[model samples]
Target: MSTALLVIDMLNRYEHDDAGALAESVGESVPNIRRLLDAARQQDSTVVYVNDNHGEWTADRRELADWALQGSRPDLVEPILPSPDVPLLVKARHSAFYATQLDYFLRTHNVDRIVLTGQVTEQCILYSALDAYVRHFDVAVPSDAVAHIHKDLSDAALAMMERNMRARVCLTDELVGVFGSR
Candidate 1:
């Protein structure tokens, strides 16, 4: 089965109310995410980025990344920036698949399984996992690669993903093993 890595909502301005806490978690997860990106690319796994548009409807991937670079925590976003060649989908809501073309994109690419990584684990990551599950795609989420604003909620969310959604919740290295390496 072909696997695609979905990097969700990592591009942020950090101007929201709980930005500091979220940024802290994202800081810790960035290295793992970077490693996942490198490993996925090296292994020939498809890599796609799904981000919040921030209402910049006209902004392309480069423009979105550039705008995010101007945020307070550009350091966190820099290491995991989506490459120009990677497909970037902008979402308006918490779930990446909600009102987005992600499902169609994955279908077109023949991606039967997906590795989800990025911010707000309790929110976007969890919702995306459910959406993916309902779409009949096997979902895998690397715990170390997802950032969350609230630890307790994220823990519960992860549990739900594994239990209800049947997602594989593992560490970055373990997920890389599942993906296989060159």
Candidate 2:
């Protein structure tokens, strides 16, 4: 099964009320996410960055990156910046596939398995997993690579995805192992 790494909503200004705490929570996942990115590149896996436009409909990827870089914590955006070869999709909703060409893009690349990694495990990550599951894509969520706003909600979301969507909930090391062994 061909796999694609979906890095969702990592580019953020963190201007919201709980932005600081969210940033702190997500900070723990950055290293794992970096590992996944490196492994994906080494294994020639498709790397697609799905980002929220933050209500700026006219803003492109560069604009979005620039805005994120100017935020209070540019460090978060710097390391995970999408490489030139990586495709970036701007989404306005929680699900990456909602009103986006993400499904088509994955199909075009012959990707049948999706490895989800990014912020707000209980929000974007959870919704994107369901969307992918309904579309018949096998989902694998590396628990270490996703951040959460609330511990309880994140745990619940992960359980729901594993039970309802049959998503493989594993760690980054296991994911990298699979990527390498393939």
Give the best candidate by TM-score: 2
61-156, model 2: which lDDT tens digit per residue? 899999999999888888899987799999999999999999999999888999999988999999999999999999999999999988899999
Query: Would you list the C-alpha lDDT of every candidate in the order shown?
Result: 0.91, 0.92
Lowest summed-lDDT stretch of 10 residues in model 2?
A: 173-182
Off by over 4 Å in 1: 180-182
Runs of candidate 2 exceeding 4 Å displacement: 180-182
Q: What's each prediction's TM-score?
A: 0.96, 0.97
Tell me the lDDT of model 2 at 25: 79
lDDT of 1 by residue, 1-182 (tens): 88889999999888899999999999889999999898888887888999999998999888999999998989998998988789899998999999999999999988899999998999999999999999999999999999999999999999999999999999998887445421
Model 1 score (lDDT): 0.91
